[model samples]
Target: MELKNRHKKCINFDLDTKELLKYFPKGTRKPYALIKEFFEKQGFDHRQYSGYISKEPISDYKLTKIIHQLSIQYIWLKNCIKEFDVSNAPQTLSLKNQIYNSIEKEENKIYNQFIQKLRYYQSKKKILNSSTKIKYEKELLNLYQKLEKNHINLDEKSLKSMREIAKTKSLKR
Candidate 1:
């Protein structure tokens, strides 16, 4: 693939960066096509272009891990590209910093709210004035234990009722 910076500086590598590289004139080049051609010379098939690759193939267990790794690689490559522009260096850095700061603020707000809820629950568990919280906790624990043992039949109606109760409790708060 040909990775070019805004300064017109370009670097070319094979599809896997392991094959032979033939330097071409800089103006216009199809990187994917070049890589495919290089692979063809190495007797490697292009799975996507050929009918050998199924459109929606069933993934085995090991393939799932491989796919996740490839997804991480794709994300990393995308991040690299987003920061690849050579011009307006200060503006690009400032934009990235602003985006990160906004994300951090949002995360902190959510974390604080979560901590508050946890503290409230902990205090309620300790107080136990009405005993209603104890009853609920006992029932929830029983249900959870049954679930862990695969003994509870979790039907839609029961799940819906539980969700409604949870929503009502949140609303009361």
Candidate 2:
């Protein structure tokens, strides 16, 4: 299995599949199979992969798609938190926080790459006017700002709250 041989496929099962199956009857065999294929393709241990696909650097297009999907999930989760009863609030919030952490991690990874690219562009002897450079700088700034806006910050306080909620939920169970 080589890195070049790995192809993107729809995954059906994830870490939460078992929990989700309690609510929905259909299992995600297709997606899970796809993930298994990816693991095999990469010569990784499928049992340990945990379905986190972006451990290696991904293409910009794939990154964009992931960010978009995460953003949509973030919005939906926020709405769910707002609308759900207090009894279920902790679980929803914990899930939301987890998603937020993922988004932030991805953004930070991309941001470092973005800066490296910009630095490389500067080091190269390319034809550029001051106006063009300014335009490029503004565009980069805008991209950073856009990513920042999409990121959800889960502070220490929130983590404490989530932990408390988890404990309470476990006690109830």
Candidate 3:
């Protein structure tokens, strides 16, 4: 499938750094530059990439890279929010809330894409011949293991179901 169609199927998050900056504490120096630098450090150049990494295709290797980058950004953003003394400034508190929301949204998008891929492979297994079934099963298992290594959660039931499919296919031959 084309990258555009894959993206259309996944959850979309509006990662507008400019809009995000509007909630930041007033009088902060070089907010735009700071946000730009943050993104760049996250392995994304907003100017060159045209936006965040969330729009990238969810192929196994690319998905791993995207999730890793997002996890790094999530940690950095959380730390930045914590460093702010929001006690005296309502605006700062609001900005923190906005940042938290963005983090959650990004994480959700990652998980949604992961689940979608698992489902895609699971559905494909049904139509594939026994010979090809093992190949698809291996791919699915590898994807699951990679996600687990990165600390991304998989639905236990879904994992079990995939395993059973693979087991049954193997037993057939």
Task: Using TM-score, give the best candidate's number.
Answer: 3
TM-score of 3: 0.30
Mind giving the per-residue lDDT tens digits that candidate 3 earns over 67-123?
466557555344333222101111211277888799778667666765776677667
lDDT score at residue 93, model 1, on the 0-100 scale = 21
Q: Which scores greater on TM-score, model 2 or model 3? A: 3
Show the lowest summed lDDT stretch of 10 residues, model 1.
83-92
Q: Residue 28 in candidate 2 has what lDDT?
A: 48
Which residue segments of model 3 deviate by more than 4 Å? 1-113, 165-173
Candidate 2 accuracy as TM-score = 0.25
Judged by lDDT, which candidate is best?
A: 3
Per-residue lDDT value at 6 in model 1: 18
Clash pairs, model 3 backbone: none
